[model samples]
Target: MKKMIALSLLLMAGMMLFARGSKESGKTVVEIWHSNSGPSGTAFDEIVDDFNSTIGEEKGIVIEAIYQGLANDVLTKVKAAASADISSLPDIAQLDATACLDMRNADYLILPESADIEISEIHPAAIEALMSDKGLLGVPFNASSLLFYYNKTLFDSLSLNPPETLDDFAAIAPLLGEKDSTGKVTRYAFAGVPATYELGAFIGAQKGLSYIVDEKNGHMGTPSKVLFEEDGTFRNFLGHWKALYDTGFVNNITSGISTEFAAGRTATMLASSSSLTAVINTVGGRFEVGTAFVPMTDEEATGGVNIGGGAFFLFDSSDAVKTVIEYFVSQDVQMKWAEDTGYLAINTALYDNPEYLAFLDENPAFKVATEQMLQSNPAVTSIWLPSAYQIYYSFQSEIRAVTEDGKDIDEAVHDMATLIQRAIDEYRAQNID
Candidate 1:
């Protein structure tokens, strides 16, 4: 069933691509390099089509969006283009929020403020996450939050309610996992990547923990510092996770967690809100799927999730390109994008729109993310140095070594903090000069 859905989606996208390739003579073309694929990619292409027919026709502009690989790959391509030739870069690019600083530092992106780009229509947090030493770094697109997804059938079988607190989750997790007579694990309670996205959300779910320090706010322009070790949150969380791993309740595999969950070998997992479409497709008729606000700690029962996704950054400086961007962020366009792609709409007005409310009524699973966004905090990793993601992966490696290899947690945390501080120092040295 999953294969058939994937194949059909590909076929439809191929047909759409073929249909959109035809040029309308005399229209000025604006090229966009983006990392969106699958359903989001398809929805973006449709948005471009709608724009070309309506606003593009009126202004004699044609928007051409091309898939330029994933978020990180897009940065490499953009950097190469910057060092090579200006013409090689696309008019617009979608960059992961963490890497926005790199492009801004390289002068590869044009600040929307310079272009007098109006952003009053976008969500406040969305706009804030894109801000830098200059002006707005990018237009937030594909904004999303972390969500707790569970197999409803399994939960029902165990007479469990969806977890609301970390305590609840821990209590219920062991109940969901199973073993054979030989004590070999046959099922897992939780499984997911232990990177910044997951860990950041976990920390935010408990108050009084700052993941990263912003230089301008309190550090007086010092490079951002890792506060996890300082606050003891990282140590406590790691201990919890390590215990779960030792008990065989949680699997620490980097990949296949979602697949394992869908296959009934795992009960719950944390994932991006934008993954709703893909998850639904993968779990097609296998069992009912449920989504809830990510579990919070007891102190922060109303804890907020972190927003973690890429945004649209402009590299071109043309009125046509700016106009297309304006149109893209408009309420109508935002709603269409949200409905088609399952991303939270950046324009706040869309939330109260009758049409969007109706759509939410029909698709409650995706709405869980939207509701979470109302109380969401900007991911601390998003504000860290441009090398933040690289540091995060390294941190994840340390976690694996500690949890799976039985390394000392305190030693691992100290080493991980040192490694991250070094990366931040290097980034500041290079960019501040």
Candidate 2:
């Protein structure tokens, strides 16, 4: 009997391919709230339209796609909405590490018993970070990886090449930095670390650096004194930043002087490869741009992608909701996402196809972004949550205080770490189900 039901479900899914939406018996309304807007947002809308034309409109499962600003913003609005609080929620919603955990923690999300995500289609690192520890919360959307982006016009004038390793990064700092009338660095060379990514790509490039060790354990490490294990590598990493700050080579943190970088005020920066597309599109007519993979230390940066861009999640409801999720997360829908938008296809098979890859070859800007996306480690960090953003801000504040207010590094880091740990505890208590 069980086998019969399983086979029946499979047959229904296969038959869905035949649902062309010309009949009246087909019309399942499944609401999908997401956070993609603008042109890409339009692309998402089209994907739903196609999916509807294919299966939902015919089989009664209509996929409704809604645009809800940034993920954090959506989560706030979602928390306020009464429907979201009830167990019977919309069929689908897009969430990040924190939102996924929060919803799943309260049993507000239902991991499809049959939904074995095509993990191979996705990078493993992202699975560790974005999806729930033991249960899958949502499918990937608009994910990206960090890369080394430089001022190509500046590099050409200076006759320089892009950095491939940490050593190379150190080597170029001096050449790219600018000193003001008082010998103070008015323009910095690199701008990756002082941002929200929290040097995740930098540490990930090294071998065996992860905040989480187990997929089922949705927890991040609480480093006693150091953010990383007491390995000399972390010490070396932080020590270098301290020196850079002291020397005034790196002034702004968290996307340091992006305006400066864009205006050619800064020479080099480390940011999302996805940002490359926008940057190039924004500056393509005016300046020459250069891009390379994020620099490495020991291992190639294949840890997994951090789920930078949000994805459409299937909210908890009934069997109808599950159907909606399946359709949206299907290989078919994901392909449209990659092709029509800047996001690389979450499906690995897309990478294997000569035709799809040829599209990348034709567009160098998208090609670079895709290349970096291919190198991502994973989307979620162990013990990371939206509350971690609070920690991120705290860390940023401490760094600025140390630099601008002349606070001691030891004192600042110690105080900041304590505050962050407290936030983590609070998040766990409030969010951990």
Candidate 3:
């Protein structure tokens, strides 16, 4: 009877242990809500599925992504959810730079250093953008900057080299232009990016302005009071772009810029280096595409940053949120993520990996893009919204109108400045000092 009683107790204890292990090891789903749509969405889902199961453990963390647009739209949704006090907000959220400001303000994110990530190792600019007034708020996942992507075949045929300066760009435009019988060019030399960012890049490069006024203070890089004020640098850049557009030198064809570039109907394109693969895939390998550092006015370009691509956000205040965010920034995940996604790798050590070098060598398409890492920089001044976002969108609209409608550069620029300033004042009035 004693032996039987002992055996029964042993069986119960083993069962209890097994149950505890099962509970501890059971799969924890980290729901990811994103708008990585189309091919990107598909690829992202596959990657997540692969990662979720790669450990071959039944209890591994399963990342469930809800495909939603670019990173910003997902952030908008997140904002709406948060406003509603929705606790079921995805455990992990990916938002673009504009949304990062909102996330930081709301305390909706956490420091990456507290997680498993190698936080200090990423590019300072990327980290700077993620840090709030208090501390680091998010991980710089899928980070990128604007770079000059050009067609090598076209440049070779015209006996031209890649233009490295704005003057170079202007000088080469006529030579490389494919003109019609009417002496009008069907293929233009340069293109502008949406949201006034590409123009801002040129302005910053020309003026040698540090994106932020003071690097240490964590104030937003650009002063709302400055950019939209009289004779501001922002106004000047818009005027120049408007002139280019009115003269038919700048083509702002909304329907087919990407297709035109892919078909080699345009000479060059300014886009995210991360989209290098998308462009290549769109080009269907018909010709070789080359990437160069974005052109400049100064002998050495100082500005190299883009305004989009979301940060990795932690929705929950629990230890899980911190742990997962760190994982997102960690050398293991971030390096591989950057490599796979064509964004700037967060880890500097990734550049040294022989395997990475081999991958780059084998994939000649990534040569210019990968090189931009050594030469490129990060996003210009972070803008916190209500007014900042309104200004950004409104500025894009006015700038687009100036270019699209062939409006006068100086007059249009001054008008836009006034309009944007009003928006800024309205915002400050509502959310005062």
Candidate 4:
């Protein structure tokens, strides 16, 4: 019965693909698999419609944008399509930044430079986030960085400022939080779980910009091992994090974080810049929200937050597909995308545009992520690994073990490194030549 159901779903998907590829007035049909949803999805669809009506119509090219669930789900579909029938694949795919390694290993994409598609206007950090040993792996579409979010009203009441470093966070945690007579925390100074996303920023923000894996964070070549254990990067970050944990004001919970912040139960959070809009909306004007760069490991730290979000991979190297890619990354479209979705515009030229400047002036929250990206160290690029998802969970669990289970920090870090290295070894054994 399960096999029959699976076969039925497969047949349905193939039929849908056939319907999508059916010719319409002899126009070149280009399909794009995307993971955008909610306002971002709506904004992307509008952009696609704009393209279809104007440039697409003029060039006799019709673009079909399909939302294929979240980033992981889209990647799964793309991989399955690659193994089943290459013809079933879309001309383009927008996948999370971490998927670059998988895409590179699969050799399933075409280089934009080879197709004469110019990307000089895009931001260098955004370009570097998707780059590999094979040159550019994808075109950055929706770009974001980690941000520090605080309840401005709470900070102002206590005469406190947003923390600039982990030491500052520890210093201010007790003052910002409230506790019961029994010494149990009733209001948290900070509430968040430092998973792979947050840990990447923390690790990258070391004195010289540390990397989790060698080969320049897997850009120069395939990463065979992680560097956290040898370089003491993880140890340094864990020391600071453990201090923050010892403050008794930090809540290491992941669920209802934004809710806790909005309800005034937590004073601050560390989250993706893309959550800026949603965070503000969830607060519903109850309190003012402020945004800043992710806190550095210490006052002497010189590194910056790594880029997050997704990039577009080209599968069919056609002029129409290139045009679509160019349209998405164009200054005008990028400005609109940033405004609508709270994502950083990949086009660096947008920063100098008079209208964009005015927009930033009006919306200061959206400006923080862009400023951080522009000032980030060149060494701070996205971590590309085939076992990125597994590594994320390992970071979460190991951190929990030290903070909650009273395990030794060194033991936890060692175990985490071992788990990550094992995952990497297994992936390389299965995938790499």
Model 3 per-residue lDDT tens digits across residues 1-433: 9999999999999999997875545667677787666445655676676566663244356666787666767877888888887685788788766664466466445455545455766666677656665566677777776778788888988788887766567667766667789987778776654454465466444444443223321244222453433435555556545444444556665456768888767888788767766787888878888778777744544655433455677665555455455556566665555555666665666667777777778776565565654554544544444445565566667777766775666676667666655655565575443
How would you order the candidates by TM-score, starting with the best? 4, 1, 3, 2
Instruction: Report lDDT (Cα) of residue 105, candidate 3.
Output: 60
Candidate 3 ranges with C-alpha deviation above 4 Å: 1-25, 56-59, 111-118, 182-184, 210-224, 228-232, 235-248, 297-301, 306-308, 317-319, 330-332, 376-379, 385-393, 397-408
lDDT of each: 0.76, 0.59, 0.63, 0.86
Q: Pairing residues by index, what is the TM-score of model 4? A: 0.92
Per-residue C-alpha lDDT of model 4 across residues 392-433, encoded as one tens digit per residue: 777888887888788887888799888878877887788746
**Number of the candidate with higher lDDT, 3 or 4:** 4
Across residues 48-122, which tens digit of lDDT does each residue of candidate 1 receive?
Answer: 899989999899999888898998888888888889997798888888756665766666678787777888878
lDDT: worst 10-residue window of model 1: 213-222
> Tell me, what's the RMSD of every candidate?
8.0, 10.4, 8.0, 5.0
- Candidate 3, residue 67: Cα displacement in angstroms equals 1.4
Evaluated with lDDT, which candidate comes out highest?
Answer: 4
Which stretches of candidate 1 lie above 4 Å from their native place? 1-24, 216-224, 301-303, 378-381
lDDT, residue 275, candidate 4: 77
- How close to the true structure is residue 207 of candidate 3, measured as C-alpha lDDT? 49
**Model 3 weakest 10-residue run by lDDT:** 212-221
Superposed model 4: Cα runs more than 4 Å off:
1-23, 180-184
